[model samples]
Target: INFNDIKEWKAALCLLRSSPNLVELEMLARPEEDNLVRPGVSFWAESNQFDCPFDQLRVVRIVDVVGIRPELDFVKFLLANSPSLEKLTVKPVSNDGGLDLLKELVRYRRASIQAEVIYVDP
Candidate 1:
């Protein structure tokens, strides 16, 4: 789904929980304002609490992810839940924390899933 607002994100997350046959998910977000600080751990914890239907998911791509805590949580959730996932791609917005985000990705890579992370220099 093309995420334009928080409402869209909420809806998408709900849909992901209900769709039992979901094989692939691609989340694209448009750039916006408001740099509110959200705790990444809480966001990830909440997402992990849900029963996501991603057991069959093989490919997940998140595009245009800004430095938002929710975005980081979302990536972390995908990494943890998508055991069968073969490919995952993330494109982060150019900002002060690009290197930090890359480090997090590297640190979270699963041994079972050969995750390839590419950060576009901006």
Candidate 2:
């Protein structure tokens, strides 16, 4: 699922819950036009934990990742649950990070034996 703002982002999660056979999921994770509101929020996760096991999910590409709590948590969930995941590509909002985000993402426990987390800049 892809979202441009908070409302869309929230709706994306619901869509995610309903998509049991989802093979891939992507989130813009920020306002496409750079709206000042960032750093993420906790309320977006206020829902029942369906823990929808992504049996077919193989790839996840999140653009404009801000490394916020919610984003990080969602990434962790994917890593832990998506047994078929083969790759996770994160393109941050900028070419920053100093490799910190990459390192953190790599530390997550992926259910897939061949899962790889890649960070890119453009």
Candidate 3:
């Protein structure tokens, strides 16, 4: 799955639920400054309740990762749900907050103990 303009969490949740058998998922995004969607809207709001588990998900590659809350939340969601996930490769759009992103993602409690995280600098 390649999410290009995924700005809202509602949309993100819907897309995630639509694909229950994804082996690999990918997204196209830029840096935080050039956010694809408008700022200030929380993607992971409390009112939105979803329990979609990725039963067949394995690899997740998000291009031009910006480490925004929504982006990171999306990653955290996958890590917490995808039991079969093997690897997560993220290529940042810039050096700013790249390390921070890694730190945050690496510490997330992943359902798959074998899940490996890779951060690529551009």
Candidate 4:
């Protein structure tokens, strides 16, 4: 997935929605190309609601996150929806704002009591 591709982001969410038995999921941002453009809208919005919980999802890994709003929102959305999630590992692009990003990630409401949010350095 490209960090700024709105279509890819939305499609990923839709795929997750349909994958009820999913266990481990990984989203890694490809290294940016010179032609990449930022999306005009956030892929996951606060007003949107999911019809079902991710009951079988146990692990999630997101890499090279730039700490953008959409990415953070997606993380929050996943945290809120994945009732069976046990671990979520996030690796940022760099150390810049890493602390703040970790704080924001931890602040989100998680559906699983045992879910642990892990922050990894670049």
| Best model per lDDT | 4
Q: Which lDDT value does model 1 have at 28?
A: 77
In model 1, where do residues sit more than 4 Å from their true spots?
A: 1-6, 34-41, 109-112
Candidate 3 residue-wise lDDT, 1-122, digit = tens: 22235544556677778988779888776443344655765555332356778889999898887676777767877788889999999888789988788898889888899999998887
Model 4 weakest 10-residue run by lDDT: 30-39
Q: Estimate TM-scores for all models.
A: 0.73, 0.74, 0.78, 0.85
Off by over 4 Å in 2: 1-10, 31-49
Worst 10 residues of 1 by lDDT: 35-44
Residue 52 error, candidate 2, Å: 1.6
After superposition, which runs of candidate 3 have C-alpha atoms over 4 Å from their true positions?
1-8, 30-41, 45-48
- Compose the digit string of candidate 1's lDDT tens values, residues 5-122: 4565577777877776777777775666653334333545476677763777777777777756566666777777776777777776565687887887767745236656556655
- Model 3: per-residue Cα lDDT at residue 88: 92
TM-score of 2: 0.74
For 82-114, candidate 4 gives per-residue lDDT tens digits of 889999999998999999999999999899999
Q: Rank the candidates by TM-score, best first.
A: 4, 3, 2, 1
Off by over 4 Å in 4: 31-40
